[model samples]
Target: MPKSKFNVGDKVRLNKRAPGYYGHLLQRTRTIISIFYDDEKQGNTYELGARGRGGSLGFFRSYMLSGVSPAQASKIGRPKTKRSYKRR
Candidate 1:
């Protein structure tokens, strides 16, 4: 079995360049609450939880998450919104 990239209680963030529908989790940091091995994928899946929030966010593949420091994880903010202009 493949080893898990991140262990339980570790802080992590979604990789900025991760492909798929992870836009909402782009800049948010979370803690790894659990890890599960996948036989089909031959990899591990992690469950993440945010500070001050109850319950787990969801499961993510190892490649989808990157390790981060506690300080870095604590610094949370929303992405800037893009402005739209009318055509001339």
Candidate 2:
């Protein structure tokens, strides 16, 4: 299997050429928290998270996200994991 374009913990930005519907996300840098592959379509979808925000924004196609520089990733830092409130 080929390697995915973006990996977990990698920072990415929505493609500038993406549709206007994604305009709200254009300026925000998001981190890749998880990836989902669809066998039927043979494509990858990513779950994104923003710094300082808990939980993920949503899933997006690989084509919609672009890789940011490692420097930029460092600046964005990692997304905070959601804590489980339920008792064991």
Candidate 3:
């Protein structure tokens, strides 16, 4: 209904409201992949992501993930990735 605060290339950190929510166990900065709305929760989806040594993190989605915050700029390893997503 309103404009989201984050953009696709922005770096961010996870903000867990409840306890025991592991959000891909990411402690480093994750880039905002995309934003969407889920009718079930009545909130915006903040799809965050990061590059890892093996593959990457934050590829999976979760309803429990509350939101994300700005984080320090860091290396976005591997330059390019084969992964991509589109809104259907």
Candidate 4:
């Protein structure tokens, strides 16, 4: 197992997706309620919670960056489409 970048009680935000229309993905903040890893502890995932009680869990939970900085979030993942050229 490896060290977790964030611990329980840490605050984080989901990386914003321009076409993200889900209400939950509306630039809200979440707290780390729990963290988990695979059986081999090779990969890590997080369980996020709202700021306070009476809150609900997010639909997208797994292998996501927590508390991503504005700069880092911008380029967190690969683009939806890859540019390919025909070899002639």
In terms of lDDT, which candidate is strongest? 2
Cα lDDT computed for each candidate against the true fold = 0.80, 0.81, 0.56, 0.63
Name model 1 segments beyond 4 Å from true: 17-20, 72-88
- TM-score of each prediction: 0.68, 0.68, 0.48, 0.52
Runs off by more than 4 Å, candidate 4 = 17-24, 54-56, 59-63, 66-88
Q: Is candidate 1 or candidate 2 better by lDDT?
A: 2
Rank ordering of all candidates by lDDT, starting from the highest: 2, 1, 4, 3
Worst 10 residues of 1 by lDDT: 70-79
User: Residues 5-75, candidate 1, lDDT per residue (tens digit)?
Assistant: 77889989989657658677868888889899988878898988866589888888887888887654443
lDDT accuracy of residue 50 in candidate 1: 60
Clashes of 1: 0
Would you give me the overall lDDT of model 2?
0.81
Q: 9-85 in candidate 4: lDDT tens per residue?
A: 77677765323655565477777787777665466667777667757565333435446544454555788688988
As for candidate 1, its clashing pairs are: none
Measured by TM-score, how close is model 4 to the native structure? 0.52
> Which clashing pairs does model 4 show?
none
Q: Which stretches of candidate 2 lie over 4 Å from their true place?
A: 72-88
User: Per-residue lDDT tens digits of candidate 3, residues 1-88?
Assistant: 4566666666665555423456456455666677777677666666655454533354323443433554468777765756789999
Error of 1 at 45 (Å): 0.3
The TM-score of candidate 2 is 0.68
